[model samples]
Target: MKRILIILVLVLICTQIKAQRPMDWAFKLNLKDYNVKYSLPKGFSHLDSMISSYCRSDWSELFQYSLINTEGDIAIRFLMIPITPKTAEQLEYRKRLFNLSELFPPNQNYLRTIYFQLEADTTNRIAYYPKAYAKKTFNVDVAGEYDRECKIVYKGKFYKSKVVFLHKEDRMDCFIHYFYEEGKEEKVRETIAKTRGMFRLR
Candidate 1:
């Protein structure tokens, strides 16, 4: 009976140790393609209609549309450029130059090197880091991260283009991402396939 009690206590200690460890994230390709599956989070409302209605969804319009999964701390947004084809019909999001500095004050040295604007599929990835909280930066780089753009080729006229982002943390390479285009299905498929196993996510 004494020996059995000791064995049970040892087993309990091992279980507690395993549970206390942080969960590690290694990027695995469970979902191979970026389909139209990720639209709205459950228990969330579509405010795109309101955004387009009250505040003209154009270049001049100062609004950024985004969706966040409360279950998981991931969010993606697009820069809505009113209903104009010229504004709406874009692959490269060059127009966003006007607003990069808007999110953070111009005086601070910010980074935008890892951004692209082909039909403007802008993505903002937020991942948590347990270590860096006590330091100056708190679980994030490129502070106040947000994006605004439109789905350029939803109709039959455009070639689909996709873009990716890597969060700048040495511990984990996780990134929040998005993509949209019209005719370049093969091109998009190839791009998605390549991203698999390349980056690790937290």
Candidate 2:
């Protein structure tokens, strides 16, 4: 009887660990002849209405994917812009300019010029990181490819963003991880970490 009870407890603990492990999904971001593969966390569903509402022509050109949680709040956004058909000199120029600093809009009027134009306003107040938080920077490694990262606060919520230019693919991919009303920062962090670990640029 004692041995059976020990085995049952061990099995229960193992099951809980497996349940907490992050799950991954692989997909493609394609534009004409350009295509890249990435592995990201699951449980997010596509928010089709965002494409029709928030997205405009210029925005649509670069917006590859928009996803949201059950509450209808966007949790992840994947943006890509192709830089092919350019001369070798142009590629080098863009690569130099494409970094974490360039990912965000100008701080002077970030909301009015960029966020408002793209996402607009939906009862959400715009809040930029103060000078201290603005200096916070991090890094992301996706299947060995590295990128500079930063955090931004929107509507009193936190988000992490990564921007990188793929030299081989000649494209720029911007990844934004949004923390919505879930109120679970640890879960969001784990998801971001897991997805970043599994990302593969093809």
Candidate 3:
């Protein structure tokens, strides 16, 4: 009887410990336009506070949130831009700038160099959400998705990174960028999918 009682107490203690552990993901930030929640992979940390300070110094208008892992190999950024007619026109113009063929005219060398510097791949395309979700959540016809493996020069070191872009245009435009170490591309993609799956728009 004493042995059984001890076993039950151990089981109860284990269950309580597990319940008290933090979730893999949680609500992280609240902004004027929307709220954001995020999760980092096993060895990562959220860097919103540090990144926010740098963003406010220069990109305060568009910067929303940012995250980075402890190893400094992965990062994510969220930006929200209000959609006015003028801004919509500018967005369209910037989209065209991604066309390599159209980039052959004025300052071709500079433009092409900048393009290759980012190593933008040819995978840009329209990303469609579920009809119900599009209508209800973002009210957008479609989102723009692009991903690539690129090289980033940071602090005098070159890092090969996989970058993913998710842009949604509605009453406001939402952009998300996910950057991870190149060799972990598949894992990063899975993480992004899971994050989006649980993403909240309030």
Candidate 4:
């Protein structure tokens, strides 16, 4: 009986180890009175704010935290910015699809804020793989749900990206991941999920 119990314990331990297959590193960011926490896959680390400029562009300027994969040049950048008026108008127009007010006054800002992030990030990433120019594919998900993917090919390798947009009462949260090498889609998804899981209002 004691031998059986010992064997059971060993099995449980092995299972636990297998379940946590991908290791992760965590970090937090404070921006405009909001606290954001997220994790990177084991080989990535947060880059200093001063050196984070490389990830920014005129359209996507509000950077929260930037991370680089230690094993390679892969990177993930987080951004948050206020919604613009034009964006609000588009959202208000879309709301009409559900018989909501074409004026959707209250949600116009909300929708535009999220839309701008999606648009800016998607465009900026395209420039990085200009040579390959593969097909650009993405989906406009429901306000609270996410399921978007973008692909870029650099040199002879393929890079996969997942961009997420979240609209808060005050601002929009944007998350982007670039798997610099080919075949890291699962890892990229896992890292993005871990980061989103740590998001907090305060």
- Provide the lowest-lDDT 10-residue window in model 3: 51-60
lDDT for model 2 comes to: 0.39
**Which candidate order results from sorting by lDDT in descending order?**
4, 3, 2, 1
What are the runs in model 4 whose C-alpha is more than 4 Å off? Answer: 1-29, 35-43, 51-64, 82-110, 113-160, 176-180
Q: In model 1, how large is the Cα lDDT of residue 193?
A: 46
**Count of clashes in candidate 2:** 0
In candidate 3, residue 69 scores what lDDT? 62
Question: For model 4, which pairs clash?
Answer: 87-112
lDDT of candidate 3? 0.45
Residue 157, candidate 1: alpha-carbon lDDT: 31
Candidate 3: tens digits of C-alpha lDDT, residues 30-136: 33334433344455555543222221222223334556666676676555444444654554565588553343322122223224424443343334456566545
**TM-scores of all predicted structures:** 0.21, 0.38, 0.46, 0.44
| Range of the 10 consecutive residues with the lowest summed lDDT in candidate 2 | 138-147
- Give the alpha carbon lDDT tens digit for every residue of 70-181 in model 2: 5443366554444444444554565577642333311222222234333554233333223332222212111111112223343344243332212222343333434344
Residue pairs that clash (backbone atoms under 3 angstroms), model 2:
none
lDDT per residue for candidate 1 within 100-193, as digits (tens), equals 3333112111222223231233244422233343123323332222232334322233222233333332221122333334444464445444
lDDT of 1: 0.31
lDDT of 4 by residue, 3-48 (tens): 9999999999998665433221222323433443333456677554
Candidate 3 residue-wise lDDT at 166: 26
